[model samples]
Structure formats: structure tokens, C-alpha cells
Target: MKRRKRKRYVSTDIRKSENGATFLSILITFVIVMITLPLLVYLLTYVQPVKHNNELSVNQFFIFLRNDVLTSEQVYTDDDNKMYFLLPTDEVAHIEQYQNVIRRQVNGRGHEIYLRDIDSFTLQPISFGTQVTIVTKEGREYEKKIAHYE
Candidate 1:
């Protein structure tokens, strides 16, 4: 009787294949980042945040004030600090400054900040009621008149 010889099977090298995939992924990521970086920077350079100017702030304040006070039963102002009132929706809303930001709070809830870099905020008396005046660090001032309903 003749004995048959068995052939040995070799397994694939996992280390080499693993290293290649890892290196390729890393190289592709690096290339993508490199390609997008310049475009991102360019877009950022042209992209300016909505400025916190006095005019815009005052206008926005008046809009909010009108909307709130139109149906409010009562309103109060702390001059440069804040204005609190009841909205038409029966929700209480307060607009005030926190540090350098102008924030609005409603129903004792979230503090929604609107404008930033406010140097000064003042409520000035007007023909009918009061006007909001916001001054920025650049010495630019904005004012808007408001009306109160009885």
C-alpha cells in the first residue's frame, strides 16, 4: 500500500491587508481635508455675522414690544435693564440685557439672546410712551419710538 502526501494550505496575511486599508483611509481623509480647507476659509472670510448694531437692535425691540404690549394688561420697564410684560398669547415675556447680550425670556422659560456687544441700553420717554435706544461701542446710536395702549 502507497501512502498519499497531504498538501499544506497557507492563510492570507491579515496584517499587510489591514495596514493597507488603514493607510488608504487616512490618506483619503487627509486629501479631503486639504481640498476643503481653503474653500472653508474663503467662505468664512466672506461670511460676516449679522452685526449687533444699534439701529437693528432698536428696530427689533420695537417690533417685539408692539407685538407684546398690543394685548398686554400691564407693562413695566427698568430703564436700561429690562422690560417685562404679558404677551397676546397670555405668556409673560421679558427683554433685558445679560452682560453684553440682549436676551428675551418668556413664561419664566428659556433665555433667548438676540443682539450682542451692546455698550448701553436705555428706555427714553416719548410722545405716547417710551422709546428704546441702544448704543454700541462704536458710538453709533439707534432709537425707535413706541406706543402704549390703555
Candidate 2:
């Protein structure tokens, strides 16, 4: 009878190297940040809050104008600096920009200042709508158009 010797196995390597997933995660994060940073800076510098006499800003005024035009039955521009909207209730509402103020008259309930600190403004008739251009005292310009009879 012959006796065979068994071989013993010894473990030596213990330290683990970085996996491909770790490198992939860092690469993905870097790409996302690179794309987002430029857009964030552009929006922060381009969109700014307006200086106002009270709570209203030029942004809010445009929102109101947009709502008015969307809900109105007809829109008309008188001369150069005046525009009117005929609402669903048959109420004639008007907006006038004179001097350095923008005024809104709702359903003949008298007029109120929509915004101030304006340098100049123009209300004109376009091919399909009325266009409003407002230049504030700070040299910031805001333009909006309201489509008529929509």
C-alpha cells in the first residue's frame, strides 16, 4: 500500500482594488455637474426680480396681461400707448402706459398703476396680436404679446 501526501493551500492576497463601478459613478457625477452648472449660471443672471414701488413686479404684470388676453374675447390697440381687452363678461378693460407708469382699468372700475419706474413703453398692433414693450428705469426691457380673439 502506498500513502499519498496532501497539498496545503495558503491565502496571501488580502487588499482589494477599486472596482469599475466606483470609477463609473465618479464619471457620471462629473458629467451631470458639468451640464447643470452652465444652465444654473445662465438662468441666475438672465432672470432677475424687478424693482418696484410695492409688491408688484414686471414679471407679475406680464402674468396678469397673459391671463387677461387669454380670457378676453377681443383685444385692440388704440393709437400707440393704449391697449384694450374685451373680457368674457363683455367688460372693456384697458391698459395705458404713460410717462413712467403702466395703468390698468378693469371693467370701468377706474384705473390703477400696474407698474412704475418705467423709462418708455410701446403698445402696437401686430399681424396676429398686440405687442407691448416696456423699458424700465433700470434699462431692463420686457416684451410680451397677447393674441386676440383666441
Best by TM-score: 2
Report lDDT (CA) for all predictions.
0.76, 0.80
lDDT (tens digit, per residue) of candidate 2 on 86-113? 8778789998875688888887577688
| Steric clashes per prediction | 0, 0
TM-score per prediction, in order, is: 0.54, 0.57
Please report how far candidate 2 places residue 101 from its true position, in Å.
Answer: 1.5
Q: Which whole-number lDDT from 0 to 100 does residue 82 have in model 2?
A: 74
Off by over 4 Å in 1: 1-58, 88-90, 125-127
User: 46-81 in candidate 1: lDDT tens per residue?
Assistant: 887876555666577668667767768777787456
Mark the regions of model 2 whose C-alpha exceeds 4 Å error after superposition.
Answer: 1-56, 107-109
